[model samples]
Target: MNWQDEAMRYEPLKAQDLYDFATAEQKQEAVEAYNRAVNKLRSGNGDVAGIALRQLAAQYPDFAEAGLLSVCCQMLWGDRRGALQILQRFSQAGYLTEDESFKTERYLAAVSSEPARETEDPGAVVVMDGENLRRDTVKPPRLLRRASADSGVEVASASEQEAFLREHNLNLKKHHYVASRSSNLLIKWLVTLLIILLLIALLLVVFLLLPQGGKTGAAATASPGLLNWSGLRLWRPVNLFQA
Candidate 1:
């Protein structure tokens, strides 16, 4: 019989059943089944692993380790969203912790591992392909020279990385108003031109309407002036200009 059938059959058959049943061997068989499922998952046989995981979860709901295994199986089976939902539900049920339910063996292993060692040759230089050196990597000794130059820049110093703002101005962060200034400048020019055009049009109108020196000289000369009116005696008209 299968692991589940064996477990169910032998569960109630205790006491004398312990002696009569294959309980110890059955538990070992169950572990073997679990290991087989885990191996399938590791080997990318996700569908088979997922079935095994589901069966294990159904048989062992209280097993936290099995819960973790089931979730991983779900993830490998391309049911990432399903796995996340299950984790969330388990967390809400107070059966999972912040890190415990979400932790992946891969992530935990990586976190617990040591840093990688650099095996690069110190004498050989590796230059990156680019038009500018600012954005490219240099191999070995050349890199050391560029780094050790009197410029006080260490090649490894992240804070003083030469290429950090190579194409951008650092001060630009503090001058957001520069764009506004440019826009205002353009508007000012437009307004000034409009005012100048208006002034020119007004001048043109005045010039067009006013009589020129010789254009209507005859008519202007014939027109009576205030002095001419003042000089007129009104005694003969009973003092018409007395005021």
Candidate 2:
């Protein structure tokens, strides 16, 4: 099918059910679909995205990326069992990349443990997912008195805000580091491929630009010598010994 074809056309898990799985090109198509689904999630249509991701992962069993995103979508929707089911499926297939595997492990760990109750609502707090539920954090000193905030807004104390910022920053740094490491690997391979292609092209050009062998030498050797005499009417070959 063309790239524009609907992702839902294939039956759920059909591709993954195949023993050989997808070819490299087919896998690329799946990757594109996965990306589209991810964008859909950002647009707030997480259901469509999640379904597409599930089908994609199941269709191409080895596509670890699709599986990971599918799990993430389920997790976002708070479907613990469903998310774990998908995770367990591909995880058993052994296609999950290192990062995906690590996340899966964390998801399982968090699921097995008690759910942290502190982060039930959005707030200016540092509570990580499924962490710091029961524990109380000390309130930091406030610089100014609390302002009369809007009714709808839930303004946290200064300490809670600070804690949120700190946690957010740490999480951002950690994620950025991990993402950069993976991206650098892809960049390295791409650059190496480009260099190899450039070298090949240069060699081809050099070979083409080089002069063919022996033509000039043969023509020079076949020509009359400079000492050959020329009359007013016509040129003539020289007989040096007779002269």
Residue range with the least summed lDDT across 10 consecutive positions in model 2: 170-179
| Best-fitting candidate, scored by TM-score | 2
Quote each prediction's TM-score.
Answer: 0.27, 0.36
Model 2 lDDT at residue 152? 28
**Model 2: CA > 4 A from native:** 1-21, 90-95, 114-243
The whole-model lDDT of each prediction reads: 0.40, 0.48
In angstroms, give how far residue 151 of model 1 lies from its true place: 77
Over 39-134, each residue of candidate 2 has an lDDT whose tens digit, in order, gives 666655455455456556656555655666665654554445655666665455454557657766765665446354433332221222222422
lDDT, residue 64, model 1: 38
Candidate 1 deviant stretches above 4 angstroms? 1-30, 92-243
Residues 1-243, candidate 1: write the lDDT tens digits.
Answer: 122221222111122222211235443343455555655545544444444455455444433344456665443333444445444434444443445454433323422342333443333121222323332222222222244234532333332222322222211111111122234566999999999999999999888877664566555445544222343622223455767
